[model samples]
Target: MTQLIFINLPVADLNRSIAFYEAVGATKNPMFSDDTAACMVLSDVIHVMLLTHDKWRTFTDRAIPDAHASAQMLLCLSRDSRDAVDAVVAQAGAAGGTADPNKPQDYGFMYGRSYADPDGHIWETMWMDPAAVAAGPEAFAAHELTPV
Candidate 1:
């Protein structure tokens, strides 16, 4: 079988998170979803498990990062077009999420915008063309850039 990723994130409230994700167009995977968690289908190979804090603590001994105070993880979604990226960001904001008020980036090959989930988890919506990206870092710009 091919490798598939299941990213588990702890949330303070399950239903609220589920609503936010659904608003952003992610459908739930009923096979792994239940009262304690909701499986958000990002793609066929990618599933996001939104677990309640108590349920998530059962899986690990490490301290869960307070999402607003420190970074636990950043989720990125790639859209087929620039407009799709913008649309998702807009939907997120209208659904109680907040889009990062930053300028749009034009790398000649790729573009990206960022948003934060209701729980303060960072998510980036981006678009990229492989042919342009293959020209090397310098092909688009002299420096590699990362979100701040």
Candidate 2:
């Protein structure tokens, strides 16, 4: 069987988080959703479990970090093209989320932008030419990594 990835996030408001993810194109999977948690289907292999802070505590003893103050991780999603990346960021902004909290990134063969959900979880939308990626490190030799 193929391995699937499930990203569990602690959300302060379950419904709001569901709406935010739906706005960004994820559909709620009712079979795995309930009052305290939601299964947001990002793709066939990628699912996001948005759990209420209370529900999240049941699984871990560690305190939940203030996402607004510190970033635990940066989640990135790839798009088919640069326009698709920009479209999702725009959708995030329209959904009461913060768009491009960091500077946008643009290389000749790649591009990316970021957004912060209402709870301040950061997500990056990116697009890269498959040919460029297949070319490997040489393709990025001239690209400088700047803070973004």
Candidate 3:
């Protein structure tokens, strides 16, 4: 069986967050969306549940931290190539998301960039060379793969 990940986030504005996710490539699954919350499908295996503060409290009693001021976590998605990573960050910027909220990373075999949604949730887009990935993590450390 394939396992799916659902990242539930508490948002200040449900509709606005939904729009931001849609602009960043997630499609709203109307089957799981309504006034209190919306399910955004980033990929077959990745889903994001955007919940209003009132709705969020039903599941957890913890205080919802201001994502803009502090980060509890950073969500990330993989891209096929380095250019693809850049493209998503560009799309995010154009869609009102703050682009490159975190420093971009480049390690020859791997590259990444990040953006923050309106609610200040940071999302990173990353890409790694297939060969490097297949060789495993130790491979990069053992061999110098600096960019030309």
Candidate 4:
């Protein structure tokens, strides 16, 4: 069987978080959803579980970090094209999320933008030309070395 990935996140407000994810294009999977948690399907292989604080606590003993104050992780999704990346970020912005708290990144062959959900969890949308990526390490060497 193919391995699937499930990214679980702690949310302060369940309904609001579900609405925000739905706005960003994820559909809720009722089989894995309930009052305290929601399973948002990003793709066939990728699912995001939005859990309320109480539900989240059941999974781990560690304290949940305040996403607004510190980034626990940056969830990234790839798009078919640069425009798609921009569009998703725009959608996120219109859905009561913050667009590009960090500057949008453009590396000629690749581009990306980010958004912060209502709970301050960061999500980044990116696009890269496969041909450019296949051109090898030299294509990104310069950008990697430059201090952003």
Cα lDDT tens digits for candidate 3, 53-133:
999999999999999999999888899999999988998888888999998988778898899998899999999889988
Global Cα lDDT for candidate 4: 0.91
Candidate with maximal TM-score: 2
Clashing pairs in 2: none
Q: Can you write out model 1's per-residue Cα lDDT over 1-148, one digit (the tens) per residue? A: 9899988888899999999999998899899899999999888888889999989999998887877777766678789988898999999899888886445666546789877778888888899977767876656576466543
The TM-score measured for candidate 2 stands at 0.95
Off by over 4 Å in 2: none
Estimate, for each residue in 20-138, the C-alpha lDDT of model 2 and write its tens digit.
99999999999999999999999999999999999999999999999889998999999999999999999999998999987899876888999999889999999999998999999
lDDT of 4 by residue, 1-148 (tens): 8899999999999999999999989999999999999999999999999999999999999999999889978988999999899898998999988999777888777888899999899998899889878989877775653313
Task: Compute the lDDT of residue 5 as modeled in candidate 4.
Answer: 100
C-alpha RMSD in Å of predicted model 1 compared with the true structure: 2.5
lDDT of 3 at 92: 88
Task: Give the candidate order by descending TM-score.
Answer: 2, 4, 3, 1
Q: With candidate 3 superimposed using the best TM-score fit, by how many Å does residue 127's alpha carbon deviate from the native?
A: 0.2
Least well predicted 10-residue stretch by lDDT in candidate 1: 139-148
Error of 4 at 55 (Å): 0.3
